[model samples]
Target: MTVYSSNVTRGLMLAAAFTAVVSRSSLRDLSSVSPIGYRIGFVTPQRLWTSSNSGRGSRPIGQIGQQHNGASWEEISNPKSSKTVKLFKAIHKANKSRRNEIGLTVAEGVRLVADLLSTENEHSKSLVRRVVISDALKQRAESPDGDQYHRELIYRLREADKKSRASRDKANAIIINTGGKDAVQACCGTVTSQGIAALVEIPTYNLDELSSEGEEEGFYLILDGLADPGNVGTICRSAVASGVRAVLLLESSCDPWSPKVVRASMGASFRLPVIEVPGDNALDRISDALKIDPKRIFAATMESSGDAGASKAHFDVDFTARPSAIILGREGEGLRPKIREALSNGRISSVHVPMSDGVESLNAAVCASIICFERCRQFAQKKSDDL
Candidate 1:
């Protein structure tokens, strides 16, 4: 074999080292780049967000031996099978409290986080102060302004993630961790080249704030005594799609913000302003939110030919004329008696969808969808005619 030049090997290694160092180094000043910097979550020395993790060989950039620790350059890879959706309700509740106490909310995933940074919607943007992502958890600004900055995803994971009775004591807040070795790992490491790409952590938001964009004629669906995340999710997806404004939760209905619901919603949940009515008071809250005074509330039933009315089919009524709060109760029992009182006393009228006699009722979500669409259709058509 021909003798190889040691000089050649040395030269190549040196070239690779310089490239790694430059490419991986955190931007000391954002102004240095031509692109506008994102006003990120609350944290400091914004570079700290990037410095601790990115330079650590966790990134695609090779040639840098920069501390891979136990995680090697050859090993770090893309998220293979991401089954769970965003950390929704738990995160939503946590941030909702933050909004009440401090005016902030949280968002997960690269696109959502990026959109918040770039969003034109005044209601949902800017309220972010902290963010946790596998791909990018960071504290970017040298100081928080108390304004806004990026904090490394790990800082929050360690400091805020521990679940205690004290944390659970809050109604809406929750602490959810990505659950496995394959999931993103937290690190105290200064260089995070080997870290997982779970960047979003604290989505910054609390729904207590009303929209400044102006509220719609605003009707909401309250899932009471109903169980099943998929059913709740389907109702929510349809509600948002048909312009029901928002959904209110009063029972142990699956957290509409959970990963499953979010995916089932097909992104409608983000666009809707759903809120929870603590405990069994959900029906009351639904009445209040719609300003129906419970006096105008209505029961939807499958029962035919009665004064409180029959299964008239939800669309048969003058949906636009009626200021209504409707309920789809438990699967087998249908509407509860307490809920029926308002309807019986003329506090509300009972309405129903006429289905085959043997067909007990539609899927809770399906019923809600058909009803909501009918109401909105009337309103939409009226609006079109007015124009």
Candidate 2:
């Protein structure tokens, strides 16, 4: 017989180790006749394996090993399966009608769910009904954040799911996996799926609740007829950053819970008070409920032919003087006639950013950001002056 080197024997041992690790049952009765030395434990979805030179002869590996403790998982392969299709419909066809009927929306990408995990808001955390992940996303390598951050996210999600199950709460969030890459792509329109997506109940907040007099006094950002999801999302992110107390989504505005808007918001939607105002007289209802003085409300607009109805510059307004509300209008048309009537009658003030002669107007989202930060700046200045 040919003489085998020690290295060759070691290679054979490693092969046995892998086989035993993947097939946990096989290791239980592994024969000692082979010199393969390895230990396996199944505590999670991932397999664990270690090699050591057990002086003992080969007996069934099972006799030497502990029981596998991994949780059970289901693998779905069909993109058209009932579960996958339902998720696709909710995420892709996120119209008001669909959302109202289903009472759910999709939050996709790893960052969204990661942020959801970290949020301190109990109500926000409770809104998540389920988290669906694609196998491809689960195996994704670490991002620039760190080598272990992705793995850490998986661990935390699993832990949270475990606790939820133990509590047996109907609202507890569940963790699930898609059957394949096709299913993941179908759900979020991206093959990557950022490794995870969440099925979250659309949070409902009444305008009256946000306007309660007992609530802390702060600026409210009102969105009017802005149909672009990207703009709506960016405005929401900016509003959160600039310390707005709440955001009012007018009926004509795009769905705040839509996937595109959710992604664009960078998770700010979860932290902010996003109330829907679904009627022709949204502003009127809000004013009445909040007991808002017309003089304290401001509408942002492009400068008109003359200064008849519009404030000359955004900087000219005294945002910090009192509790204020800023209204952002539709993309192309600017504010509606009713809003302008408020401005013209001096019931509400109109504030506009002075632009160069050639530029007619800024994007709705950009205008909102500028006005919001201006308010932040003014508030900061006021705080400093008081000091």
Global Cα lDDT for candidate 2: 0.64
My TM-score estimates for the predictions, one after another, are 0.51, 0.75
Best by TM-score: 2
Best by lDDT: 2
Measured on C-alpha atoms, candidate 1 has an lDDT of 0.44
Model 1 TM-score is: 0.51
Q: lDDT by residue for model 1 over 222-258, one digit each (tens)?
A: 6666667678767877986787766666555555555
Q: Report lDDT per candidate.
A: 0.44, 0.64
Q: Give the poorly placed runs of model 1, Cα more than 4 Å off.
A: 1-216, 306-312, 384-387
- The residue ranges of model 2 lying beyond 4 angstroms of the native Cα positions read 1-72, 82-85, 119-121, 141-149, 304-312
- Tens digit of per-residue lDDT, candidate 2, span 167-219: 53323435455446666666674555665667665555556655546543568
